[model samples]
Target: DVAKGYILYLEDISVSFDGFKAINELNLYIKEGELRCIIGPNGAGKTTMMDIITGKTRPDQGSAWFGQNINLLELSEPEIAQAGIGRKFQKPTVFEQLSVFANLELSMAGEKGVWTTLTATLTGEQRDRIDNVLVKIGLIEHRYQDAGSLSHGQKQWLEIGMLLMQNPKLLLVDEPVAGMTHQEMDRTGELLTSLAGEHSIVLVEHDMDFVRSLAKQVTVLHQGSVLAEGSMAQVQADPRVVEVYLGE
Candidate 1:
């Protein structure tokens, strides 16, 4: 039976690469509008799990669903993205030469040819949307600036703002605060937490302090499967997690 409140479901999923099981019978779920943090040591199958969800990799056994009726396994990568799933890798990939406002403009949902995108004019509503996202990402003042000149953290936020322009239902973020200063990390945490009620977020990070700052549920992955799921404190207290990850 399909679950009622979940925005994502990964059940009994497994994938192997060259005979090594990367994700083995992993089960994970995200409730609508919830922010979930995933953490694990290296080789813990975290990336593969994200791959499965985003349609970049298919599992050998089990199912992945986006919503009540959307079968994720049957969709192409672009199709999945069109269906409202967005992913941001650890590295920021904004258009360096373009202005921040222009970057968000090009990222808005729709099929646009290069010629059309270059010449198109924005409607009042569209401009408002971009402004809204700019505010959300704390980049309104930097809107007219070249993306290349922004700091590391600002680039990451701009990229996230670009994703928001597409109005995704779920976002998968990979190590967003890896190189951020403590202040930037705090800002990022605030931005992400603010987005949770409108869009479900699955954040994969190794920064335990940043994860704890979010104060959300945390999932610990080990050996290609979920080892622990609870609050940050709860998982830290979990002997299994400490032995495998935290203690190291």
Candidate 2:
């Protein structure tokens, strides 16, 4: 797998906040189209690691690369995003008053100065892509509905759909299933599973059962660095992981 050309490569990344180290000598990688799950306890540097990857937080040392050619550390936050990395925070941030379709349309990665109305000259190819994403996100029927009218799970999906409009190469999603019912969680799991093979996904989630259902390669972080990496069963049986969960 070393030769598959990883979409993301982070080596020896370290970062500190104030007097405390939030990330220490972290090394992580995600192969093209791989679905990876990250699980960790509080203060485990999960968010900080994402911040580093997205250029929101600069690491004290080490390198972050989008591919062999691009030096992620050299790019600004907006530049990194423009380079095909999209991140979804824990909370949904859709335009409540806009229609679902409008929300997705506004999230287009190109020049926002182009004006949402009055025909920004989208290619037939681009329009087709938007139509397809709407179907994939299960929002086709709700296209005309105000985003505020969608349920929580639907809102989450809309936000994800908005991210998809950017056509990102890698998506960093945090706590996607939080505040959802079991049915919503299950559907969300299916959606994420469906996303694999087409995109590389790094998911940070807490629901063990949901993680098991997705069953992608799992990485567990502790004390600002990687503590364990394996399948669910393998990590669950690790003495360190078991002890940490039980002790906390």
Candidate 3:
């Protein structure tokens, strides 16, 4: 049996929009409990690749598989999400009017296909899980505070907390440190680093410093394909990477 140690596998994925190939023969893999970062210049198909993984855009060719048994290309977007793949966009989207606790509660997947008030009766397990996530997100003290009142970083954390409520096996985060203050970025880095061993995380970011702090493996994309992949030091040392970054 194959070890089944990989959380995600993309094999020669290619996507074309209006006859122009945005992603071409992209091959990538993320191991279980690993934190990987994807970096690329503009037009590198970074966003399109993410969309393909999340089922927003179907690839024109190749395969995307989750774990050993699941063929992701056959799943719908919501189905993919339900299969323990969580994605966070560059912008924070939280329930502004809802209190922080309420926001997290609404995100609980165990509640079935319906929306309920935070004060509604919840199973003991559900309540305990929410409480634990609140603590992990560092918002236990502000549980009752309105999410709208939180700082930018706090709102971002709240959104992440919401995603955490679903207990995803893999997290896809895009530009998490963008527009964040240095202090907030450091905290976010710590939070993501802590999540590595528990949840496989793939971070797409342009910030080299942030990637250095978070990535165990880094893949650089250019011209709709992987330009280089390795540790930050290894990729940075590649002449192709240097020429790509500095020559332009």
Candidate 4:
């Protein structure tokens, strides 16, 4: 019953490193086509939780499910990825020497082998998809520019666009707006919000303003478990949340 209709679910999940319980008896659920925001001060098991869901780390106890029938805990990292869960790291990993369009072309769904990838040709649909993603991320103007020449914010959007090529069922984005201009932050918020109903998104971000702007539901993690869950306004008003952030 862990999954139900959730795109992702964790029930009584616990994990340890040495003697420290990184995640203890954690329970979380994310509905299909919903964008969920997860926030915490630091070491609240956010990364650990993502690792567990992606099968990069196995939990010491409890269950993790992807959709209705997929047992994420039983799958390996590659298998989890192939199952339509895409993860973006805190830093952009786009090919700096490649043009934005080329980078996206390289990310299209198919065999990733070097020979096959380099020789593959994009069909009409794939080209249209890339063009649409370019517009969505607001990188249409820079489509032909080398990734190295773009601003940090543009690079981030390009990386996100690369992820879009996979047509993932769920997107796990980490600190997406960490380094960017205020204008870029607002645009990034818009980009993420636009993807909600089409693709379930799980964002781990420290930017309160950005979270407030984009998050419909916010989950606060402290001491490796949920301290509160609500809208940004509701959670900010919670005395427990205030205490945790202020160390009171």
| Highest-scoring model, TM-score | 1
Error of 3 at 19 (Å): 2.6
Top-down lDDT ranking: 1, 4, 3, 2
TM-score of 2: 0.94
Candidates ranked, most accurate by TM-score first: 1, 4, 3, 2
- Writing each residue's lDDT as its tens digit, candidate 4 over 1-248 gives 55366999888899989989999899889999889999998888899989998999999999988999899988989999999999999999999998999898888877677566667786798789999999999999999999999999999999999999988999999999998999999989999889888999999999999999885899998877888999999999999999888972
**Local error of candidate 2 at residue 203 (angstroms):** 0.5
Task: Give the distance in Å from residue 163's predicted Cα in candidate 4 to where it truly belongs.
Answer: 0.9
lDDT of each: 0.95, 0.89, 0.89, 0.90
Model 4 ranges off by over 4 Å: none
lDDT of each residue in 1-248, candidate 2, tens digit only: 23347999988888988978899899898898998999988888999999999998999998888966779999999999998999999999999998898888788777656465336766787777778888988889999999999999999999999999998889999999999999999888888888877888999998899899987899999988889999999999999999888877
Question: How close is every model to the real structure, measured as TM-score?
Answer: 0.98, 0.94, 0.95, 0.96
Candidate 4 displacement at residue 233 in angstroms: 1.0
By summed lDDT, the worst window of 10 consecutive residues in model 2 runs over: 111-120
lDDT of 3 by residue, 1-248 (tens): 22378989999998888989899999988999899999988788889989998999999999888988889999999999999999999999998998998888889887454445444688788879989988887888999999999999989888989999998999999999899999999999988888888999999998899888765799999888999999999999999999888865
Instruction: Summarize candidate 1's per-residue lDDT along 112-142 as a digit string, tens digits.
Output: 8756876988889989999999999999999
- The model with the greatest lDDT is 1
Between candidates 2 and 3, the one scoring higher on lDDT is 3
- Candidate 2 lDDT score relative to the true structure: 0.89
Where model 2 places Cα greater than 4 Å from the true spot, the runs are: 1-4, 112-123
